[model samples]
Target chain A: MFAKRHVISMREFSREEIDSVLDLAESLEPYARGGGCDALSGKILALLFFEPSTRTRLSFETAMMRLGGKTLSLGPTEGSAMAKGESLADTIRVIGAYADALVIRHPKEGSARLASQFSPVPVLNAGDGAGHHPTQTLLDLYTIRKESRLEDLRIALVGDLKYGRTVHSLAYALALYGADITLVSPQTLEMPDRIKADLAGKGTMVRETHALEDVLGEVDVLYITRIQKERFPDPYEYQKVAKSYRIGAESLAGARDRLIIMHPLPRVDEIAPEVDETRHAVYFRQSFYGVPVRMALLKMLIGDRLE
Target chain B: MNDGEMKLRVTPIGNGTVIDHIPAGQALNVLKILGIDRTTQATISLLMNVSSRRSGRKDIVKVEDRELKEEEVNKISLIAPGATINIIRDRRVVDKYTVDMPDLIVGVLRCPNPSCISNTNEPINSRFIVKSKNPVILRCVYCEQAIAENIADYLI
Candidate 1:
């Protein structure tokens, strides 16, 4: 078997591979409940983030610590040889020599892919521009499975699907397992046609709706995403679309008891804070479980023997 | 014969291959596309910055003892979509090959979309379903980002 060397995008994993990770995460809940540390003792994880982050960087660091491993966090784009004009290839080559494994975040569209090409170690993408985030999608999948059943589930993705890298990656993983996906957003914020066509090709039920209320009672999983200001050029455009897509308990009154609300966080109001109190609120758990799921991910990635 | 020894005479293509009306400035894009840039395997003759009756200034590459296949003709259509190709057999022109728009291209143009699904990790090969040919539009099989005609490149 080829070494599982890179995780630049979620689209790289097959349905079977994703299922395997979910199964590992299922068992990981015990570790989470028991509060054990040292699953990956003494291992070193290199976090090379050129862009600013909140949830992803901290989540991976927490995952490493909980596993009894060490982490080396590099600050955003300022401190490294990057400021001195070292090429991305040279940076990865130098980093690969020191770190056992590498996690990278860069502003270039294919930065993770480029890192994987040069780095000798496993290169995990923390986030790549307005592109894909494979690990985030994995936790999101695990969250959906834990909060509610995943197979054939009705999943409605709301907010900025056009610029939401999380939604783009998540929608494909949802389709890989055969979910009925309803993409609800403003016309300009609508799901890109490429993803729509892919779902259509797979015969996955997809609909574009302007109002979330129309689909509120109908969906099993309300996967909400925020308008990423960083993904847009103009702040004014971001401000205009931000108001229309908030998820609160008022909208959830008609939703199913089994319903789950999720967002790739550091949210800017697409999801109301009040929704976090509801039983349907799984975003925090989703965000929290990222630590353990990623623990399993890093362990699986680095080939550590697990009992 | 290879290298300079394998050269195409400047004489008018007596009834053979009609590499008609190549863009004078870009005969090199066509030559590079044909995999001739570094090869010393064949005798090469090129006409550059020449006046084309069809295109204002033109570039041409006439390779001796080389014939393009049907699939290759399709590729020629893409690189210089306006350029023409001709068949040469026994020093005689047999059939003229005209450039045509491609509906589903196998492997020539690269998808221009940086966020395209084919640009991702899954073990699956990349694919683009053609939406239009005129202003070529392609929908990536994975991410579903539609890359415009020139910006998106497609492969088999």
Candidate 2:
């Protein structure tokens, strides 16, 4: 049913669509765990990464391979036609001819949507610079559902709310499920006013705080993100808030027993290593869920079976 | 009679459009938006710093033989929300309507984001949903990037 549909923004999805993807991801767990599936035997998935990524790129490739689909990848701008000054539209139009679908990760905001406009096939946004990442939102939803109840839970999204595209997408998606959201970030890195207004329009309960400790015990899910050093135009500002909201074992002492810690990884010092052993730690498992979730998306988008 | 009481009325156009009540100092932006500066044939008159009871200071533009489209009026509202659009026919004002802020705008203004897909070589037209009217906040439909000030810089 999702054939040829571009997944550029989580804002475009309804609650039912989010649920369907989560349900499909749950069903495809075994298949993602390496159980055989040839739903896309001859399909070719093209991956275009204009920015550095580890889990997102790897999971998408793994998802395609697990679905018996082949992949063609263009990694880093240095070696690609981009290095030769090829336009994003030209690259997308050219690659759209060779692949059945495209997954693009660009450093520029809205580049994925731009790519999708030129691409003939469905274009899934891996991550866009300070913009929406629909697939990551899907996997995060799947992870949230798996770890804790998705509806009516307190979710505190901590660190770099201004620039974290993942948190931006997640906040919008969580609003759909009527989740009470507490945004934790430095004063300089608060969530954008428009996003807060959007959440308010949706009747989503949103509160902002600078300290993770203030809301750690109250939230069911502590969604953590690194303070992206590259997003800052000023190095001094980055250094000022680099370690402002860290989560260690000491910080988790007052947290709920069922509190699930989730992070879109390549984490810096925002999360301590000691927090990794706690029962609250599910970030790695959350990362593992990305494969099945992406496989579900690919299947829904390109596979023969709609259900 | 004193110059103030002399009633200096702008000469009426036989058939054209008049944009009135534009915020003072923004007539140039209105001209740029309507492409009046580039139009070589049309007879255009621009009145700046005119007195107005409603806004105190206003600007006006009269374009001969040109009736503005709905989209053009909406674009004008982005820069001058309280401006009025007047259609003149046979030297008489036929229809006059205040420009209302549009909910959605298409292909009039370029997105401020340098990396926005609309800025790229893609054939996509930039689209925005008006979020606020007084200050004129435009949120890009594709990128969700909000532009609040200096919107004239992004006018297409």
TM-score of chain B of each: 0.68, 0.86
Least well predicted 10-residue stretch by lDDT in candidate 1 chain A? A298-307
lDDT for residue A176 in candidate 2, whole number 0-100: 90
Candidate 1: tens digits of C-alpha lDDT, residues A57-129: 8888877776678899776677778788777778888888887789988775666776787788888988777
lDDT string, candidate 2, A1-307, tens digits: 2433888888889888888888888998999997748988899999998888878889999999999989999966898888887888889999999998999988778888788778888889988876778888888899899999897889999888886767878998899999999999988789988778888989986998887788988989999988877877899888877756778888888999899999988787878999999999999999999999998888888774434
Query: Which portions of model 2 show Cα errors greater than 4 Å?
Result: A1-4, A228-244, A304-307, B1-9, B92-95, B100-102, B114-125, B132-135
| Cα lDDT over the full model 1 | 0.72
Candidate 2: residue A246 lDDT (0-100) = 78
Per-residue lDDT of B1-156 in model 2, one digit per residue for the tens? Answer: 234642466766899899999999999999887666764588889888887888888898888898988677767888898888889999899998998877888887898888676787656778899888877788997678899998878888
Per-candidate TM-scores read 0.74, 0.88
Error of 2 at A91 (Å): 1.6
lDDT of 1 by residue, B38-85 (tens): 745666667776655566676666766677665655555544667777
- For candidate 1, report its TM-score: 0.74
Interface RMSD of each: 7.6, 2.0
Cα RMSD, model 1: 7.6
Fnat for every candidate: 0.03, 0.57
Show the lowest summed lDDT stretch of 10 residues, model 2 chain A.
Answer: A1-10
